[model samples]
Target: MRIRATVATVTAAALSAALAVTALAAPAAGAEQDDTPTQIKNIEVNQNRDYTVVVEAARKVKFPISALVHDPSGIKSVSFSLQHGATEAEVDGRIAQVGPSRCVKVDESWSKCEAVMIADPYTNVRSNALAGAWGINIVAVDGEGNVTREDYMPLARIKRKTHLSLADATPEPVKKGKNLTVKARMIVASWEKHKDVPLIGHQVLLQFRQGASGPFKTLKKVRTDRNGWATATVQATVDGQYRYDFAGTSLTQARSGLADFVDVK
Candidate 1:
């Protein structure tokens, strides 16, 4: 009976130690299974010109990240970084910090977040780092500490102010019903170099005002030649002011200045 009692005591002690180890290991296994990978989908970037990503002048740029977080604890935050290259560390000073802004919950497991990036004209024009291909980084985190990150390269370009000039209408004093010539020139920013160059193949509108205080009416449209010069001919009817309007493009803004006056006898 004494030997049997000692054997029973040893078996009980071994069972207790095994139970303690199993209890500790169970939580770790559960943790591994609970970690569900987050999914990112339907990402977009824009600079306020429809879906175009080109940036000209100072404007509010937007980056939207759509994601489906699989963790049961829900999403915690979403962060964005705008940089010149693929990675943040590749371009240090050029990177713009976009906020871990509030994500709008679309459904139980899906959300969308937007980050507004400010493009400063002066800062971008001066920095060579901002002129080329730029990228955005999106990071999403869940309450359970699971993280998902994605990278995208959005085509972008920095623009400069264009110079437009309308020369005085040739033949200042002209007879009624005679054709009068309107001439103008446009100078646009060059992306390849720092200097501005003559803008070619752009449409320029010729507008005429009946009198000094009257509204201007569109007379005709003329395309600029290789020399950045546009010419249009209109029949002189009365004393009026003439000007050229250059409609903007994806890379530049529309421009018009003071009009040139002409007298008809």
Candidate 2:
């Protein structure tokens, strides 16, 4: 009976030591689980130009986020409803959510997500959706429920299409002292119509070059009319080329290609 009692006491002590070790380990495991720092890397957007978001991580992010992501399903949640400049109210309906199928494992520690954003004029546009600066809010959740979030990503929405052309020039070959009439047209995308339309009341520069390999000199600044056309008159003094340059706006910039040469007698 004395030997049996000693054996039972030893077993109880061992069990208590095992329970103490497990209690000490529980907090450590929880700390490791919460220490994950999931982050966005190599974030890029195809905005005015295809560029990496290196400057502010918030500036010039292209609208419609899905267009930039590789896998749309990887992104857990995203929102462009926050208007930094515009007066549009936050609409939760605009929030985009992606499923697990769109996410792909980059490694054991991280995953890549992708999603798309839709532009709604009534709900998305506050003042002018196009040709304005905006903000985006994002929340990324991994399979382990580890979350990464970023607010106030800068975005610029510019969807303008500009065109400049030297429509007609009087008398292909003319005497040196003769007057030359030049007509040009400028076209830009209409924000309301979603199509190319005339850009009225915009300055168009008429430039002239003395020779084939000479630098262009601005001869005149003409403004487009209701028809998006500008006309200028100049004296034919030398055999050279003529082109039109449309000074871009906050929305778009355009320049005419090399115009056909005009030979002066």
Assess candidate 2 and give its TM-score to the true structure.
0.61
Lowest lDDT 10-mer window, candidate 1? 1-10
Q: Among these predicted structures, which one has the highest TM-score?
A: 2
- Cα lDDT tens digits for candidate 2, 1-265: 0011111112243344434433443333434344344455544333425321111111222232422222222333222223344322432223232232244566554554444443433333212334444445444443333334444434533334566775577888889999998888887654455455787898888888887876888999899899998888999999988878875655564456456578999
Q: Lowest-scoring 10 consecutive residues by lDDT in candidate 2?
A: 1-10
In model 2, what are the clashing residue pairs, if there are any?
58-154, 66-115, 66-116, 71-114, 72-114, 73-102, 74-102, 74-113
| Clash count for each candidate, listed in order shown | 0, 8
- Say which candidate scores most in lDDT: 1
Query: Candidate 1 on 1-265: residue-level lDDT in tens?
Result: 0011111112233344434433443433336433556666655556333333433333433434233334355666666655564443454334454455667777887777666555554453344345555555555566544444555554343334567895558787999999899898887755345556788899988998888887878899889899888888989999989998987774565688469988899
Q: Name the regions of candidate 2 deviating beyond 4 angstroms.
A: 1-32, 35-37, 47-129, 213-215
Candidate 1 overall Cα lDDT vs. reference?
0.60
Q: List the residue pairs that clash in candidate 1.
A: none
Each model's lDDT comes to 0.60, 0.51
TM-score of each: 0.52, 0.61
